[model samples]
Target: MSGAQRETTEYAVPAGVLGLKGPVEKPAPGTLPLRGDLAHIALAGSHLAAHYVIPHVRTVGTEGAGLRLAPRADGEIFATLPAGSRFELLDVAGEWVWGCPGPQGPTGWCRASDLASAES
Candidate 1:
C-alpha cells in the first residue's frame, strides 16, 4: 500500500439499473428505421438496440418506389420515393428492404428490386 491511496465510489443500485431517470420517448415504428433488435448506426445514442448497423446507400430505380408500412406488397404506402432518390438501406427480407431516405426520416419498406446500389 502506497502513501497515496485511491478514492473509491459506490452506487446504491446495480450497474444494469442505471439509466435515464425518466421515461424516454421513442419514435413511432414506421417513423424510424429502428426495430427492437436493430437500429441505424446514427441512432446509436438516441435509441436502444441489440445491434446498430451502418446503412448502405442505395438509389431508387428509374420507375421510383413506394415506402410501405410493412414488407408485404399490400401493406399501406406511407411515402413515395421518386426515381433516383437516395435511400439509407437498413434491413432486408425477401423482396422488401427496410430503411429511410435519410438519418432523420419517415422510414418504411420498399421493394428491393426497386432500388439499385448508388455506386452503380
Candidate 2:
C-alpha cells in the first residue's frame, strides 16, 4: 500500500457513530444476516437523524430531560437519547414511562419529561 493519508470531508454527524453494536433486532427463520453498520444518520451531504420511530410515541422531549434506566431523576443513565430520539412505549405509571430504543430493544424507564409521551 502506498503511504497516503487524506482526511475525509466532515459532515454534520460523523459516520463512525452511525454503526450499531449488533443487529437492530433478530432475524426470522431463513432471514439473511444484517451488517453491523446498518443504522445511518443523515449529514449535510445527507441529513441528520430525523426520527427514531418507536411503537407508540406520545411526546418527544430534549436532553435537558435526560434518559435513565428508571423513571426517577437519580436513576442510572442508560443512553442519551438526544432531542427527537424515537422510543417505543412500554409501560406508563403516573409521571414515568418505560421505553426502549425499538421493539426488541433493552427495556428501561425514562422520566416522563424525557419522553415524547408519558401516556399509554
Candidate 3:
C-alpha cells in the first residue's frame, strides 16, 4: 500500500442477478461461484467502434460484422454479425465461448471460459 491509487468497477444486478438471458460475468477472474446456463460471449476488451469480422467465420448468414451502431435494448439486437465472418475475442471474462452456430457458422462471439471445463 504505497499510496498507489486503485479504481474499481461494480457489476449491477443485471450482471449478478440470476435468470438473466445475457451472459453472466464473474466478479473476479478465475472465479465461478455464481452462474447458470447462460451463453458466454467474447468482447474486444474495450468497446470498439468498428470491429471488423474475420473472413470464413460464421454468423447470421449476412456478411460483415461491424461496430455497435446504435443503442440496444436489454434483449434486443446488440450487433450485426455477418455470415462467414469471424471476429477475434479480446479480453474475455471467461475461458470457453458457447452458443449455437448461425446459418453461416457461429452465432456470435461468446466466452469459452466455463465451456473449457465441461466434459464432452
For candidate 2, write residues 50-78 as lDDT tens digits: 34221454445755234555467787765
What is the Cα-based lDDT of residue 102 in candidate 3? 27
Which 10 consecutive residues of model 2 have the lowest summed lDDT?
A: 30-39
Candidate 1 segments whose C-alpha is farther than 4 A from its true place: 1-22, 117-120
Among the numbered candidates, top lDDT falls to 1
Distance from true location, Cα of 47 in model 2, Å? 36
Model 2: C-alpha RMSD to truth? 13.3
Candidate order by TM-score, highest to lowest? 1, 2, 3
Model 1 TM-score is 0.77
Relative to the true structure, candidate 1 has a C-alpha RMSD (angstroms) of 9.3
Candidate 1 displacement at residue 75 in angstroms: 0.6
Overlapping backbone residue pairs in candidate 2 total 5
**What tens-digit string does per-residue lDDT give for candidate 3 at 1-120?**
777654432211233233435443443321211123321232223112233222222233333433221212222333444445444332233432323332222333343321223233
Q: In candidate 1, what residue range of length 10 has the lowest lDDT sum?
A: 7-16
Please, what are the lDDT tens digits per residue for candidate 1 over residues 1-120?
Answer: 657654432212332443445555888877877888898766655567798777888888998889988899789888899998888889989989999887787899999999975463
Please report, in order, the local distance difference test score of every candidate based on alpha carbons: 0.78, 0.47, 0.30
